[model samples]
Target: MDLTGKVAIVTGSGQGLGLAYARELARRGAAVVVNDINADTANAAVAAITAEGGKAHAVTGAVGSTEVAQALVDGAVETFGRLDILVTNAGMLRDKVVWKMTDEDFDQVLNVHMRGTFTCVRAAAIRMREQGEGGRIICIGSPAGQRGNFGQTNYSGAKAGILGMVRTWAMELQRANITVNAVVPVAATAMTETVPFLKPYVEAMHNGEQLPSFARRELGFGGPEDAAGIVAFLAGDAAAEVTGQAVGVGGDRLALWSHPDMTTTAYHDGGWDAEAIEQEWPTTFADHLESVGEKLPEEASAQ
Candidate 1:
C-alpha cells in the first residue's frame, strides 16, 4: 500500500479523474510530476499535494508530441531521481456520429488520446528499460471503447486503439519487467457530464444528492476519487504480477473485462463461395452474430 521512493507522472492532472490519480499516488508517498495543459490547475495540483505533505511538481503542456512526452519524463527524472510509474490519463472528446464527424474532430481526438498515449508511454518505456529497475505503465480506457457509443466516433476509436496498444506493450515490455495495464473508469467528470443521458446524475452528484442504486451499482458512476484507488493499486508492487488487464472501477462496482476473441468459427474446404456462405451462414454463423453500441437498462437511462 506504500509507494515510498517511487517517482511517478500523471498526465492531465490539472483536474477531474487525472487529478484524483495524481493525489492518490502522492498520498501513497510517491513523488509525482503533475502534467496539464493549463498553468493554473497544474500549479494548483502541485500546491495541493504539497499541502498534504506529499511531493509534487507541475509540468504544464499539451501531450501527444514527442517533445512534450520526453520533457515530462525528463521532468520526473530530474526532480525525483528516478521514474517508477507513468499514468497516461490525459484525454479529450470530440463527440459526433460518423457522418457528422469532421476531419478536425476525428484527428484531434486521436491525436490527444491515442497518439498522446503512444508518445508518453514510448518515452517512459525507454527510460524504464534503461533504469532496469522495472516500472508501471497505466493507460486509460473507456466503456465507450469497449462497446460503441452514439456520437462518440472519435472517442471510442481512440480508446479502443489505446487498449490494443496496452496489450502489445504488455508483451513488448515484459522482458524489461515493465507492466502495462488499462483502467476503465466511470465517474462524474466534465467528460461524463456532457453526455445527454447522464446530465441529471452528474448534476445530482454536484448538488450533494444521493445517486440512485442503479447509477452506483449498474452504471458504475460516482465521484472521481472512487475510481482513483484502482490506479494507485495498479501503480504499486502489490499489482506487480497484474498486467495486460482492463480493470473497471466506480462506485459500488469493480469488474474485469475480457479481451476480444472470436466467439464462433466454422471451416469450409477451399473456403466457401458467396453461394456456399449464404447456404451455411444461418446454421454456422447467424446464431453467433454480435450487437454493438453501449447497452444500458431502460431504468438506468430513464433516471
Candidate 2:
C-alpha cells in the first residue's frame, strides 16, 4: 500500500503500539503528524522518522481537548499540505471493578479514548471532506471492550464506545468516502505489562528471552509491530471497502469480528405481563442463553 504524499495524524505515537503505527505509516511514505501528550516522546518519534528520511512533525497536547484535536488537523494540513488518514490511538487505563472505580478514573478513560477519538475524527473529517478526497479513520479498540475484563469497567466502557463511533461514522461519512473502522490489538505493550499475570512474560520478552509456551499460546507473539501492520493496511486505499467493522490483530493472526445482532426472540400477540413472561421464560430463551466469559458447556468440555 503506497501512501506516498498522504498525510496522517497518529495520536499517542510517543510509544508502544501508537509509536509502531506512526513508524510504519512514515515508512510507507506518509508524512506523519505524531501527536503525544508528552513532548519528549513526541520529539523522539519525530526524530526517528526524520533519521530514516521520512517526513514527520511533532504535536504535543492532550488528545481529549477540542483545541488540541483541531491543532493536530491544522498542523497536518499546514505541514504536509493535506490530511488523508487519522489513527486515534491515544488512551489511558484506570482499572477498577465497578464498585471501586472512581468518577475521576471513569471520566479520564472515557475522555481520552472515546471523546478524544470523536474530537480528532470530527476535526479530520472536515478537512478530508473539504479537500474532496476520502480519508481513513482508524480507532484503537481492546479485547476487554469486546468481552468484559475483570477490574476494567472504565477502560472497557470507553473502548466499546469507540467501536460504536466507528460504526456510526462509517455510515455517516460513507457519502464523503471516509471510512471508519476499529482495530482491537493484543500485544505486549506498556499497557499490557501492567497486568500482573502478563507482566513476567512481557518483561522477559523485553529482555530478549523466549516466552513460555503457555504465554505464547495465549497471547500469541507479543510485540507492537505485530499490530502495526493491520493499522497500516486499514489506513491505505486498499481497505476502502472495509469500514464499519472491528478487526483483531495479534502475532500472525488477523480476524474479523461480528457485530451485535438478535440471535433469537420471543413474540407474543399481546405483551405479556411480568408473571406471564416469567412462566414462559425458560422455554422461550433459556436454552440459547450464553455465559459471560465462556462457551457453552458442550463446547467448553470439548475444548
Candidate 3:
C-alpha cells in the first residue's frame, strides 16, 4: 500500500504503538502529524521520521478535549495542506477491580479512549466530508474490549465503545467514502509491558532474546511495530471499502474478529413469564452461553 501525498494525524504517537504507526505511515510516504501529551517524545518522533526522509510534524496535547482534537486536525491541514488519515492511538490505563475502582479512574480511561475517540473522529469526519474526498479513521481496540478482561472495567468499556462507534460511523460515513475501522492489537507496548506476569516476556523481548513460538503464534504477542503494518494498509487505497471491521494483528498472526451477533434464538409468542423462563432457561440458554474474559494461554495473568 502507498500513501504518497496524503496528510495523516496519529494521536498518542509520541511512543509505543502510536509511535510505530506514525513511523509506518510516514515510511509509506504520508505527511504525518504526530500527536502526544509529551512534547519531548512528540518532537523526537518527528525527528525520527524526518531523519529517514519521511515528512512529519509534532502536535503536543492530550486528546480527549474538543479543542485539542480540533487543533490536531487543523495541524494536519495547515502543516501538510490536507487530511486523509487519522489513527486514534492515544490512551491511558488505570487498572483496578470494579469495587476498588474510583470515579476518577473510570472517567479518566473513558475520557481518553472512548470520548477522545469520539471527539477526534467527529473533527476528522467533518474535515474529510468538507474536502469531498474519502478518508481513513483507524481506532484502536483491545482483547479486553472484545472479551472482558479482569481489572479492566474502565478500559474494556471504553474500547468496546470505540468498536460500537466504528460500526455506527461506518454506516453514517459510507456515502462519503470515509472508511472507519478498529484495530485490536496485542503487543508489547508501554501500556501492557508492565503486567506482572508479562514483565519477564517484555524484558526478554527488549533484551533481544527469542521468546517461545507460542507467544507470537498463539498469544499474538510481540513488539508494537509488528502490528503497525495493518494500520498502514487500512490507511491506504486498497482498504477504501474496508470499513466497520475489527481486525486483530500481532507477531506471526492476523485475525478478523467477529462483530457481536446472536448465536442462539428462541421464540415466545407474547413473552414467557418468569416461572416458564426459569423452567426452560437451562435447556434453552445455558448450553449456548458464551464464555467471557481474554482467551489467554494458562501462562499469563487473566488481565
Residues 1-303, model 2: lDDT tens digits:
889989999999999999899999999999999988989989999999899989999999989989999999999988989999999999898888899989999999999998999999999999999998899999999888887778988888888889988999999999999999999998898788876556776888889997665554445546888889988899997898989999988766678878988887877778889987898889978788754531223422342
Better of 1 and 3 by TM-score: 1
Which of the two candidates, 2 or 3, achieves a greater TM-score against the reference? Answer: 3
Instruction: Give the clashing residue pairs of candidate 1, or none.
Output: none
Who is ahead in lDDT, 1 or 2?
1
Q: Pick the candidate with the highest lDDT.
A: 1
Could you give candidate 1's per-residue lDDT for residues 129-205 as a string of tens digits? 99999999999999999998989989999999999999999999998999999999999998999887778889999
Model 2 lDDT, residue 211, Cα: 64
lDDT of each: 0.94, 0.87, 0.93
Please give the distance, in angstroms, between residue 278's alpha carbon in candidate 3 and its true position after superposition. Answer: 1.0
lDDT of 3 at 38: 90
lDDT of 3: 0.93
Ranking by TM-score: 1, 3, 2
Candidate achieving the largest TM-score: 1
> What's the lDDT for residue 38 in model 2?
88
Instruction: Arrange candidates by lDDT, descending.
Output: 1, 3, 2
Clash pairs, model 3 backbone: none
lDDT of 3 by residue, 106-129 (tens): 999999999999999999999999
